[model samples]
Target: MFDQSRGFRDDAVETCPVEYVVRKDGKPFAFLNATPALATRTVTGFALATPEADWTFERI
Candidate 1:
């Protein structure tokens, strides 16, 4: 994922990559690209919304 949200310079905010893995019915189902800050929240929300499935994130 390309996240243009953080950096030391305002005009040159570097993009950060985040990867998300979500499972359904005990099987991997989705791979998402998201912002680093939002990655954790996204996984948490998914786990909460879909209690039967598992979710996780990987920093790249």
Candidate 2:
């Protein structure tokens, strides 16, 4: 998935990297960092609205 919300920037602001992993039970799991980013600076006291449950996908 490609997100272009912040446009193309070298600082990678508002970017969230996602990785897929397999759990011990062999179930696919997605790990993502929802932390907000600032250009060449540290973000403090910032909160993003994230889903409370894990994301699920179904094949058509």
lDDT of the candidates, in the order given: 0.61, 0.33
Q: After TM-score superposition, what is the CA distance of residue 28 in candidate 2 from its true location, in Å?
A: 1.8
Candidate 1 residue pairs in backbone clash: none
Question: How would you encode candidate 2's per-residue C-alpha lDDT over 1-60 as one tens digit per residue?
Answer: 444885565554346443323222234443333433331121111111223433332221
RMSD of 1: 6.6
Worst 10 residues of 2 by lDDT: 39-48
- Which residue ranges in model 2 land beyond 4 Å of their true spot? 1-7, 17-24, 29-60
TM-score of each: 0.47, 0.19
- Model 1 error, position 45 (Å): 1.0
lDDT of 1 at 54: 56
lDDT of 1 at 39: 67
The runs of at least 3 residues in candidate 1 whose Cα sits more than 4 Å from the true structure, single-residue gaps closed, are 1-15
Residue-level lDDT of model 1, residues 1-60, one tens digit each, is 333565244522234445666556656767777665566677788889878765655543
Error of 1 at 3 (Å): 18
* Maximum-TM-score candidate: 1
